[model samples]
Target: MGLALFELPAVSYEGNLKEITDQLVILVLDDGRTFNFKRSTNTKFFKNSKALKAAELKPGDRVALVAKLDDRAFLVASTVTFVEMTAERSAEIAAGVRRAQETADAASPVRGWDGPQLKRRALDEPGPIPDPRAGQSPSDDPLIAKAQDAALSFSEALPNFLCEERMQRFSRDSRMIGWKPLDTISAEVIYEDGRESYRNLKINDRPTNKKMEELSGSWSTGEFNTTLRNLFHPASAAVFQSAEYSRLLDLPARVYDFEVRQENSHWNIQVDFQKITPGYKGSVWIEPASGRVLRMEMQAVDLPPEFPMDQVETAVDYAFLPIGAAAVLLPVHAENLGCQRGTDYCNRNVIDFRNYRKYVSDSTVKFDP
Candidate 1:
């Protein structure tokens, strides 16, 4: 029999670009698999039918590529195309904008982080409180050291637990009017082996198969301890300033304002399919007596003008609640707010955590509206 040659057919792949190099591109698929596709001189690149230079490629861009096996059995890209928003994605964005308008016309609670009154209070009243550490650097303050220790302990000592999370999503126009009730979302949050995940989701009292992070409109996770860990983690190299004595929820607190540089920031913002990391500044309220973090707030800083979001901020309040047979400190409430760039559209979410219990391997979860 004569020797025969076989050639594999070209395959198509679609994913978000994670890295782009001169010779190859790394893409992370929606299913979390990472693939590397070699680029050759014969490969063509395009966006909206327009030719693009290799240098123009950026990470986080959605791309579709066709690749064929080379003589060496390596997958080599023959054509790369940048994907624009699909009809479904465009419709979702439009619905979010429409909801922002509808919220302006509806009646609901006036509570929002962006309200003028709250803005003024945030900017003015929180002024430096007279304290013994007024003249010292925040790093030298004993209170900060104690708070950092407490945060580290919380991260390490927390046991695996499950909790019910209730989130009320709202939207409002730029007029700073009252917020309107949009929908209520309920999910089972699992903290296992120092990781957090969500399941058993219910939107507006209706069950859904979608993950909490995959939901349309605004949603957030990691309120349990992620932010606290990031803020107080020694490796984050956050800059702190202006330690002040204050009260949070009637408990004596040591307040410190801190900023995390973009190089060291773990805060990731995702809009549609694009992702960006922006530096953030925030305030942490720590109970002086126990060094526990009572509350924490953050606001994104120096966001790219081209980014879709104009402003992003969050505040979380922590409290000690009985979980199983022990009293555990966990997030009791959280507020997340974001506004569209150059538009009146904004989304706000108020989240509450309750019904905490120790997580077991065989525990079954039922959705509770």
Candidate 2:
């Protein structure tokens, strides 16, 4: 038989031990719910014996609990386990990846380019092998020489693309209001070489009040997931193409010139956002066989004064394996850039965001293609 919701043990509850008298301990839930229970003396799950001691239970530590509802309250029967915060895993992975990227950057040598001359040479190159009876010109074919030119142009302009992101902060108690759900907020973030940064944000279709005080500030390490989702969102491409905001980061309204270079199995395209002031310098790493953006990196100066101007470096590592006619881009791992500012202030600003909803496109592009 399927278990009922109440019968199943709740994994974690953030609460405090309210009253401890005799063998019973009372806990006050964050939502103002209350429960009375006693630690199971027969269980061997808690690693330390002190974990069961009445005085050792703290207010903030998440506890996995099992309880039975009584007439007016709950009776806790057992303490199954303790909950591990997501930040613990995020920090561990972020640390390992940053070290590997540092070694790669140091060993790789920087190269310069002559844009116009390179473009001319590519234009004069031979077209793809022909097909009989099609009668299509080399330039007319969708996968022909001209298509290569268009792709190259798209790649070159990538460095100059700028994304604008926004973040909303909420207090721990704010979850009770159920007004602004955490899942609705969309953000683009980049983390690489032990650094974390925001790229852009898409927040609309929701109501905001002038009377509601805005919680605006930086984020904490525990909140890294918010930024991670933003960077991986596919709509970021469209945002870079926007005429109004694109100029803010110094990228051209249109891409007329582009150049391509090869790095391993990936093609790196250098783009010029010349019309945008201070210009953008960046490259898009595409899988040559599948034409998917494996990763992208861009740097720009002359940002608006209010925007943070710190240097940013990030990378997303992908694993490619043939799956029938096309290669698939599998997310083997990702690394974030380290923070320049300390985490002291961020800890104080930690906000509990709840009710998250993810927005995915109807025509989603596979990471492989």
Candidate 3:
């Protein structure tokens, strides 16, 4: 067979502006993927069939962007067009407005990179250290008992509940500087009787097809819910190390970093962080007064020679979301990122729990209607 070549088509997503940070424009596309794009002077912007500015693009606006992977390996928008009706017209903007494009000469790039980067600010920076305690033990620390009690109380109080789960995975841009959207998974996660279940609801905003394995939640389920309930359970085998002070959700907290190592096996499901190092290392953040776990961070330690992954970092942020009429501390967001050694390859899972409801029943059935 003879090999023929064709121009690779560009990637684009149509969605509403979900968020605008220092350097990145996050779009929640109707297709389910939350596309992250870097805006540069070469990036064009428009509004109402006229050339506007990027700053003029607000959340909730209907827009379309024609983007291409840039030399830096980032998704850069070549043109951004806004669709809007005349102030009084009830009709949609004319089709011609979709062609408007303007060069943004004033937008500034925050990171040293030439464009917007996806590195989450809150996740990367471990904020300043609180109340230096270089050599202190939990024996005499009053906060320890209080925080421990809070964690236990929180776990014991955990009720059967359900929430909307949106998980997006990112893989390192093969030729770019950072990661790009690899797949988006939306599911419903429910926890009851110490058991968790995730129902794959949609993939890329489309119904799940059993034939497509990547869209299935089976691979990413089970890890977070159990880890949530067991991490601070006084009986866990993981050992705590340094105790320091930190803040989560803008509230004071006592942080305890710990490690969990495997005895003699390699990691099975996901990359085993403990295999390379002594164990998996992470920290727990507990609210000082009320004693509830607010946040947790974990990273694989001591990667071994020839290990497939170079680094692994994961974080989960907790908030008291409503379930029926009761409010309970639950995982609102969780992310897992695995980086390959000696390559730009990276894999990240971004999970969000929302729309919580009380667990009504555990029975489920499926059939063709």
Order by TM-score, highest first: 1, 3, 2
Per-residue lDDT over 224-261 for candidate 3, one digit per residue giving the tens place of the 0 to 100 score = 35554455445545666556666666777667776666
What lDDT tens digits, residue by residue, belong to model 2 across residues 1-369? Answer: 997655544334444455555566555443224455654454222423335554544655555555543444334455534445578855764565566446544543221211101011122123222334244332243332332343334323222111112333322222133223232233333333323343233334243432112222323231222222332233222122201111101221111111121111121111110011222334333333333443333333222221222222233333443433443332333322211121111111212222221212221211110
Scored by TM-score, the top model is 1
lDDT of model 3 at position 350: 81
Which regions of candidate 2 deviate over 4 angstroms? 1-280, 321-327, 338-369
Cα displacement (angstroms), candidate 1, residue 193, comes to 1.5
Worst 10 residues of 1 by lDDT: 116-125
Clashes of each: 0, 21, 3
Candidate 2, poorest ten consecutive residues by summed lDDT: 267-276
lDDT scores in order: 0.77, 0.31, 0.60
Candidate 3 ranges beyond 4 A from true positions: 1-134, 139-142, 149-155, 173-176, 209-219, 222-224, 233-244, 264-278, 304-306, 362-369
Best by lDDT: 1
Order the candidates by lDDT, highest first. Answer: 1, 3, 2
